[model samples]
Target: MTGAESWAREQGDAYISLVSRRAGEFYRALANEDAATFFKKPL
Candidate 1:
């Protein structure tokens, strides 16, 4: 894999953690029932 892709894969867990946190922020702004859209989309 390319260097960036390898790095991302190595840090994939961290990336997902951050994305979940962001989704939580969005959920707080909107509502829990509708937050799936944010979480399901690829970052």
Candidate 2:
């Protein structure tokens, strides 16, 4: 995770990840906050 964050920093980009609902707790524990909620729909 640190490596990924560092790479993002080097590129001057924000570190973003898509995590499953079940893993939300784990990511939150790592100091990551929920940036947005995504929803899906049948087309």
Candidate 3:
């Protein structure tokens, strides 16, 4: 994670990843915040 973040910084890009709903709390506990929320609709 550290290496990836560093590389992203060098390239002037944001480091992001997707976490499963079950693991959301785990990542949040690490001080990572959600950049956005996704929604789905079924026709």
Candidate 4:
């Protein structure tokens, strides 16, 4: 791919990773009954 396309793909991957992290945190928080702490981190 072109340089610009590569950069876009990288950004997409980063976003997907972030979303996945957030979802995992949210799920864990629900399981543990600590929603406040889950929203406090990088996710």
Candidate 5:
């Protein structure tokens, strides 16, 4: 899959890049969370 960094560098869109990157990091962090915590919030 194309990453935010790739698109950021290619298109030079800093804002979208930041958002995409943070979204990725957020999801990655979420993956490591326990089921109880994971289900704490809605998707």
Candidate 6:
């Protein structure tokens, strides 16, 4: 993978670790997720 992709993967791991059912940061983190990944449908 490219450097950016690798970096994102690493960051994703960190995010997954930080995710919690008790906290609402998961939604905020998901909101910050790259739009390209969030919206992959063809327009």
lDDT of each: 0.46, 0.84, 0.78, 0.46, 0.46, 0.46
> Candidate 1 lDDT, tens digit per residue, 1-43?
2465458788764332223554566744543343233435568
Candidate 4 residue-pair clash tally: 0
Candidate 4, 1-43: lDDT as tens digits: 2465468687775311222455666745544333233345565
Question: Which pairs clash inside model 1?
Answer: none
Writing each residue's lDDT as its tens digit, candidate 2 over 1-43 gives: 8888888899998666775779888888989999888898999
TM-score of each: 0.26, 0.72, 0.53, 0.26, 0.24, 0.27
Cα misplacement distance, residue 10 of candidate 2 (Å)? 1.0
Give the top-scoring candidate (TM-score).
Answer: 2
Where is model 2 more than 4 Å wrong at Cα? none
Model 3 CA deviation exceeding 4 Å by range: 14-19
Model 4 residue pairs with clashes: none
- Tens-place lDDT digits, model 3, residues 1-43: 6787788899999666775668788888877788777788998
Q: Considering TM-score, which of the candidate structures 1 and 3 is the better prediction for this target?
A: 3
- Best candidate per lDDT, number? 2
Per-residue accuracy of model 5 over 1-43 as CA lDDT, tens digit each: 2575577779876533122423556755644322232224667
Task: Give the poorly placed runs of model 5, Cα more than 4 Å off.
Answer: 17-43
User: In model 5, how many backbone clashes occur?
Assistant: 0
- What is the Å distance of residue 6 in model 6 from its true position? 0.0
Residue 16, candidate 4: alpha-carbon lDDT: 16
For candidate 2, which ten residues in a row score worst on lDDT? 13-22
Give the poorly placed runs of model 4, Cα more than 4 Å off.
13-43
Better of 5 and 6 by lDDT: 5
